[model samples]
Target: MASPRELTTPATLTEESVRRYREDGFVHVPRLLSPEEVSVYRAAAESILERDMEVWAGGDDGAAVEVNYTTQVWRKDETLRRLALHPALTGIAGRLAGVPLRLYSSEVLVKEPEGAPPTLLHDDEAGLPMDGLEQTLTAWIALVDVPVERGCLSYIPGSHLRADSERLRHMTSFEQFREPDEVWPDFPWRPRVTVPLRAGDVAFHHCRTLHWAGGNETDARRVGHGVIYMDAGTTYLPGVMDEYLAHMEPGQPLDDAELFPIVTS
Candidate 1:
């Protein structure tokens, strides 16, 4: 386990890992957080979800939502904010991206045992409200050990190389309302790489990489923190987050310190 001071220090990445990210569009980093760090984050996340978050249900059944997420969590809890801005996290993200990055958003995701459904396979680029989409990525940090049966993430290797226009078209036309196994008949299929992580492990994937997670079968909840990082000059576009970024011009760069701060050491 890393000492408290070491947890705040910038993480070191190897050339092999950077190369893997460039070629595969995803890379896993082991022990990104210490055991002590995980305990603190897990407690903070659980408390925030229970007390502050209003989890939204996806279906029209009007069922009471008891699991899932709160977006931009960094803006709510100081402890979670520290996790988002942690030097190790930002440093690893910057290194993997091979460029300066700006924080786009951070979310806490939870999949309850036995009840949560499997997340569908999709690329973030299909839904993101940003220009220069190629330069965006997400770092998913596990707060607890996530085995295959406990909702670990899986990705189609190198799928990020596909054209963005095609992905968006297919997503809008065919994937809007379907189950995880359901997809457009012509959608290209590839073998997936399932990534199981220890409590402190983190996996970084390109925004365009096709990915999904399995439902938790174990008794414990599968909790994760995902932080999206984009190129420093990424500009705003009209979409899901329009209300939040309404102050900025349609094509304006998202440089606001409060919402989209630069990830620095």
Candidate 2:
């Protein structure tokens, strides 16, 4: 590997890119990150994943289901936090969402080599367990080369328009969420490109965009770092909320500087 390059803030989001994201509910930003930077953070992500595995293994009755996971890891890893707060990506997220932003969560997804389970097609807002929400977005950064066969993300075009697909919102449980084809029978499948990523590319999608990943059959693992951002000034609605944020009390404002600090360039 070559020496790491000087890490700086990300470039401004282009008008066409923003337009594409608004129209499609998802946009692929090519090479938003440098290979050197991805390499550095890839190791960081893997370390946190391996560390979690060890913890699970060390516990009593350590044997768990054979599955794919590595969620909410940034809480413990500094390197992950760095990537989550990187200005380049956050700048685009803020612009796309048309609001200041704060991190909702940072998760690491690992699709292990050979027959790794595919991610369920679902919307991020559905599982929030809250009602009346701000426009949130997710930045999915590819840490390694991810082809379609390796479980790259597939999204439904224009799925963000509430008027276009509102009835499907009630199906929020990711466990019960099915592939996009069955969601809205009236809209029909639109002929469009799927969102895949290179090692350093970042794909930003609206929180409610219909998306899914296929099973990974490759020998190489496909791993990605994902950051979800909520519109600034958004609050937690414990009344309709669920277990995801059980730690925090109900009705707490989400723009907590110490916890979900704003990511500004």
Candidate 3:
């Protein structure tokens, strides 16, 4: 196992990967975590999920097959918090963002055996209550082998590069209200790419990238840890998420030492 300092000192990323992330709006890093580390996270995530947590199933009709998830596990578990601020992870995010980054939030998402439904296509920025939406992205670490049969993630390539337009705006709004099982054949978003990851692999996607995951068709469980990172200067948008971020005023930086630790400086 590599020491934390070693992991932080030299990030495991290539210039080509960075360029590909910029062009495609996402990048995959194989074996970002060691087998032992994968075991640790799997245990931690499972323990956290075992406790009472929120369950979100897409639209109104999807509640029957809700996906179980818990956010900000870093607040409760030291190991997860360390993973959230891991140097290698932060280094990848900072290099991709071209700026220093800070922790926005961390979540563990799970799909039960034959119980989870397909996730709707949506951009993270539409749901996040932050001003610097463009500067945000998520590092999704697979704790278990996520094959297509197990509902791996899929994304619209280069979707992040599209300028804000009426069509994009409408599509974002429509997605928010669409049912979990609904699929628009002529929805216009195209050239989608599905990514299957083995345990210990990580996928990084821009917040604006349109992405979704399939249903858990296999009998095994599918679990993923997603750590959202954003520019250090990103500010809170008061009305959107007043309950969770009321401590900070509108336009104020999300720099709480304990809540939003600076990952890259």
Candidate 4:
């Protein structure tokens, strides 16, 4: 395995990259990690998975199928924490956001074999009171190869810039948006492109990007680990933000606590 510095270049996002992002709502960054780093994190995750299975009883497929390991990884895994704060990503995030960035949270999303369901298409901002678009972003890193047949992510290009009314109709989750079919009755469901990623590739998407991941149809599992980033000066929405902040001690900033601990300043 190569060092992260050796594996990734110092990404200087161009106007075209920014323009594409503004127009498409997301961009796929290829080969963001070296094979070595990918292996380290995957092994760490596999260790946790094995432990979870051993400690917990009753290996019912349905119960095991729905599991999503996230918070625990951030709390106990150093390798994952390092990956969350990788310089290549944070620098690009800062440039894209035009401000200092802080890691908001990290999660491990595992779409189990065969029985996993399709995730609803929606924007992250629908559930929060964000004042503007540039304040929040997400870096979704693929830990294994993901093909469309194996439940790769699909997005509606340029939909991030759509009006609230138009956007709302495409979201169907508790996140406060309608399903895509409801919004675009005449539009065909064909994806613009199926984002195929190698183990180390990462995709950076805006908070408002309308995206979804289908179920894992193959025998092998599809897994992604996401580290959400927010511009340092961004404020938290009062009601919904309170739930995550409640666990913090008085006077402690939200980024300083365990839940949204700042992996990078």
Best by lDDT: 1
Local distance difference test, candidate 2 = 0.72
Q: What lDDT tens digits, residue by residue, belong to model 3 across residues 1-265?
A: 5454332222557778889999999988777777888899899888888884677744476364536789888787888887887777777888888877888889888888875788767777756667766668999989999998887899887877766642232222333444222333433746789999998888899987889988898999999989999878887765433477866677887877777888877
Q: Report the backbone clash tally of model 4.
A: 4
Better of 2 and 4 by lDDT: 2
TM-score of each: 0.87, 0.82, 0.86, 0.76
Report the candidate with higher lDDT, 2 versus 3. Answer: 3
Task: Report the alpha-carbon TM-score of model 4 versus the true structure.
Answer: 0.76
Off by over 4 Å in 2: 1-12, 53-67, 130-132, 168-183, 238-244, 247-250
Model 1 lDDT-worst window of ten: 169-178
| Per-structure clash totals for the candidates | 0, 1, 0, 4
- In order, the Cα lDDT scores of the candidates are 0.80, 0.72, 0.77, 0.65
The per-prediction CA RMSD against the true structure, in angstroms, equals 3.8, 5.2, 4.4, 5.4
Cα error of candidate 1 at position 246, Å? 2.4
Better of 1 and 3 by lDDT: 1
- Model 4 lDDT per residue over 1-265, tens place: 4444454444545667766776787878777777888888888776666555322221355454443555545656788778787788777766666565667777777777776666656667665433333557888788888887667787777666666655552222344445655765533554554577778888878887777777787788777887788756555444333455554454334455455544345
TM-score of 2: 0.82
- On TM-score, who's better, 3 or 4? 3
lDDT of 2 by residue, 1-265 (tens): 2234433234444688888888889988877788888999999988888877422121226332223446666677888888998878888787788777778788887777887656666677766644445578899999998898887888877777756355354433435544555656644645545667889888888887877777788899888988888876666665322566677765667766867788752
